[model samples]
Target chain A: MASPLPQLQPEVAEKFRSTVIPCRIEMPRLGLTFDLRTLTLAEALELMKIPDFTYLVPRPKRRKAASSSTSK
Target chain B: MNTFSLTHLKGPQGDDNTPGLLGYVLVAREDAFSKIAKAPKTGTTAGETAIITDNHTFTNADDGFAKVYLTLDSNMLKAAITGERDGRGLKISFEGFHPGNNAEALEFMRIVKNLGLIILVPDADGTYLQVGAEGLPVEFAPDYDSGKLSSGRRGFTVKGEAYANGMYIYAGTVKYKA
Candidate 1:
């Protein structure tokens, strides 16, 4: 029987699980640390509206092009 | 958690009294910290390197009570109460012919000179709300309102930059007596 849901690789599943863990934000200048719970997809969408919060996210790296020398 | 009600809105004296804002200007940063530190041991010599320790002791004498003045402006008061004013930008105006002519002027000059910190406490007895900011760099704009004679009060504005992440609020409450 065909599975109803698409299969996910183990690495992908591990990444998804790690995203659900809570994190701590440290402000050394203020000498304060705030514990932040994992955000739901909806909460992340809401946070995207904030400029400062959006700046914290890193951009994805670009893929390298294949070279003719590797074709051997 | 402290709860507020209409009944609790009464003045510190339990009447419809209007409380003024009391400003406490802290000394220069290092001096202020040193003042706040506890006194060294009685037998410790001033020049002894052993007397200098990383541990600090705080005492009541370290209270940084610099000056008390009445802040009469309603708009400023509202801004202080709501914390809506920008912590990075603060402007204080004073009416005087010259700087340092009055107590307020002197305090303003001192703040500008010292890169002083400020704590604003409501001048009402039993009120426990305090708003503070540290490491403020102040600039003086003398004769900011030289042409304004209609209001009868002329003054200059002292602009300052409040330190980022330096603003803090403290709220205290009294227990209800049975």
Candidate 2:
């Protein structure tokens, strides 16, 4: 059965899944390895389970800080 | 001198209690991650490293035009983006939203939080502000009188709604220039 939800673009979906929420991150040159709790873009979208929710790829803007935070 | 700008409008059911906000962030031309790594770890509470931002829209449900402008440095943005350094090069800007009517400024911040984003606030001495609740330094400018001093961005300003959004909001002209 085909699901009814609109699907994300393959590239967009892949990037979101990888960069947005990384389960494992390893920067070999920097000798960096950190376990990430961040959600892949897909996961974040998945968490936002709503019929009207839309994902927008923002136009390139200024580079923001490296980390992401959430506060309610 | 540089400029950044944004606009806020309400969606359907535009309500004054629901102001909309759209924001953007930019680092100085020569900024680097190393600088961030060495940046003072002074103004942070809750071990915050990443920042949150939002795009807000509010409507009065009556007027096509109400209060408008991108808001970031306002009370909300300040609370979301936090840091410790005094002189950083990163800048943020706001873009307009829809509905363009009745909305409260703080409500927009709540929207961002609900969406899982944070804002940064600046402190006195023209440095980033921090929240007492968490003790984190923010990256946006402090709130103040609009008429007393212009934010430099001249889009559409509604009276009785005087509040500084942030450096980007104030720098209306420099938004595209930067």
For all candidates, the clash counts are 1, 62
True-structure RMSD for candidate 2: 21.1
TM-score of chain A of 1: 0.30
* Residue B7 local lDDT, model 2: 32
Please report, as a residue range, the 10-residue window in candidate 1 chain B with the lowest summed lDDT. B169-178
Please write out the lDDT profile of model 1 over residues B3-108, one tens digit for every residue. 2112223345756555553342212232343222221233233322212222211122222223333224421222322235563433332221332246676556
Distance from true location, Cα of B35 in model 1, Å: 7.3
Best by TM-score: 1
Q: Please report the candidate that would top lDDT against the real structure.
A: 1
Candidate 2 per-residue lDDT over residues A1-72, each given as its tens digit: 753433344544544432122232222222333323433456445434633222233335556774665433
**Candidate 2 chain A minimal-lDDT segment of 10 residues:** A18-27
Model 2: CA > 4 A from native: A1-8, A11-16, A19-72, B1-106, B109-134, B139-178
Predicted candidate 2 versus true structure: per-residue lDDT over B146-169, tens digit per residue: 232543442222111112222321
- i-RMS of candidate 2: 17.4
Local lDDT at A1 for model 1: 75
